[model samples]
Target: MTVKQPDLSFTQNPQWIAERETHWGPIEGFLKENNRKEVVEQLKKLFFTGVIDNPEDVREGFAILYYPLQTAEAWDYLFQDVRLNPKCFKEFMNASLMGSYNEKFFLDDEARLRFFDYFHPATYQPVIKSRVPIGREQKIVQIEVDRFEILRDMAAKFSQFLGGSEVPVIYYRLDYFFSFLDEACDVMDVSNNDKDDIQYFANNFLQRYFKIESDLEPKNRGEQKAFLVRFYNHIANNPVHPSIKAIWQKVLDEHD
Candidate 1:
């Protein structure tokens, strides 16, 4: 299946995959060592903290993600590129981050912004200035949710990543999404109207996007009981729009 490609700095650097796998695996270790509070703090430091410490010039291979220190829209796109700050981890790892290989901890701009707003309701968001982590020593970036281009780019990029993937990736994306969105509701204070939009997006992305080139289909009767049992549990653990749960019930009825 030809997944759609949005405008992005898409690269297939085989080296980056090896680099991340060599260092970090899943975030479970990070989660295990740190309590949920500590995990949130570390994530804030990694992805939310953003700064342009080195203002000298663009590093050679990483121009796509170079930090634009000066302000001059006329200067160049290199300087004008206003992405969710990559200064946090990019500077530390010397890598072009993102993709399935990068230990899933890489929060896109949307998630970062969600985190920021949740934590700092009163503080006006800015290009956060992040330094090296005091203990973890991993650099990261910051982002916001108001930007449409970022989310479009993210959905497109994720579509590409997910187009021809396995079951685990689907599970990861869905699980991460519900968890993230569930928290975002609390953090961003999602109203019913806002949730309508979220519901629409979630429906398309989860049902339509994941099936672009994948073979994952609805389950059968033998598993329906197990499915419904967990459905209730998952809803409690990560409450999403009721309509979403309704979709689950719809599927269950159809199968029945």
Candidate 2:
């Protein structure tokens, strides 16, 4: 009788291979479809939470998402002009004068130079002339918060040079005048409801620190008109304010 070999065939097991292939197919398809959306969501989270420094990543994510549903031209058009405030110098200067600790001290030389170029004497004279720092002592304090350090430092320097307290008074006036600007610029982007809430809290909080009576008073048309006139006068006579003016001039001259 002929010997018979035992039959063994595991290679024909299509069931095992079929399940493995099926498991990965859906994952690959999902990644292909939702990659852009996932990137956008991540970028949004990063930006809103302050995890990212620049908005460039968010723009790239947008471009990726737009490419599938939009034309190349359309995608380019959406992100072609990406311009943020190059230098928030005015804001810095205003905050410093207002006694609010903003990021003025941290800015580099390039940013400072750009700031002067953007708001040179010729361009910003009218604005400076309109707003004048009030000389009256609304309040008195020995120590101010860090934001006013720039003005304070400048005043101290001026005192050393001039041998009197004239510059200190000017710094005080400039601080008061710029505080209004700081508040205005801060709330510009906030929604009406959010602004109202912020204003309510700020008005109450500021009352404790400042001598001014009413913070809730709306900036009406008449008040604005008069304030503008005073502001221009102040800017025109900025030389009277020793510290900030000297620093501004120095920065300007450096640029020149």
Top candidate when judged by lDDT against the true structure: 1
RMSD to true structure for each model, in Å? 17.0, 25.6
- 209-239 in candidate 1: lDDT tens per residue? 2232343234322232332244357765666
- The CA-based lDDT of model 1 is what? 0.34
Q: After the best TM-score superposition of candidate 1, give how far the Cα of residue 205 lies from its true spot, in angstroms.
A: 6.2
lDDT for 33 in candidate 2 is: 65
**Candidate 2 TM-score, true structure as reference:** 0.18
Stretches of model 2 off by over 4 angstroms after superposition: 1-80, 83-110, 122-124, 127-256
Candidate 2: what lDDT? 0.32
Report lDDT (Cα) of residue 146, candidate 1. 35
Worst 10 residues of 2 by lDDT: 129-138
Q: How far is candidate 2 from the true structure (C-alpha RMSD, Å)?
A: 25.6
Task: Compose the digit string of candidate 2's lDDT tens values, residues 173-223.
Answer: 444435423323323233333444443333332222222233223323333
Q: Top model by TM-score, which number?
A: 1
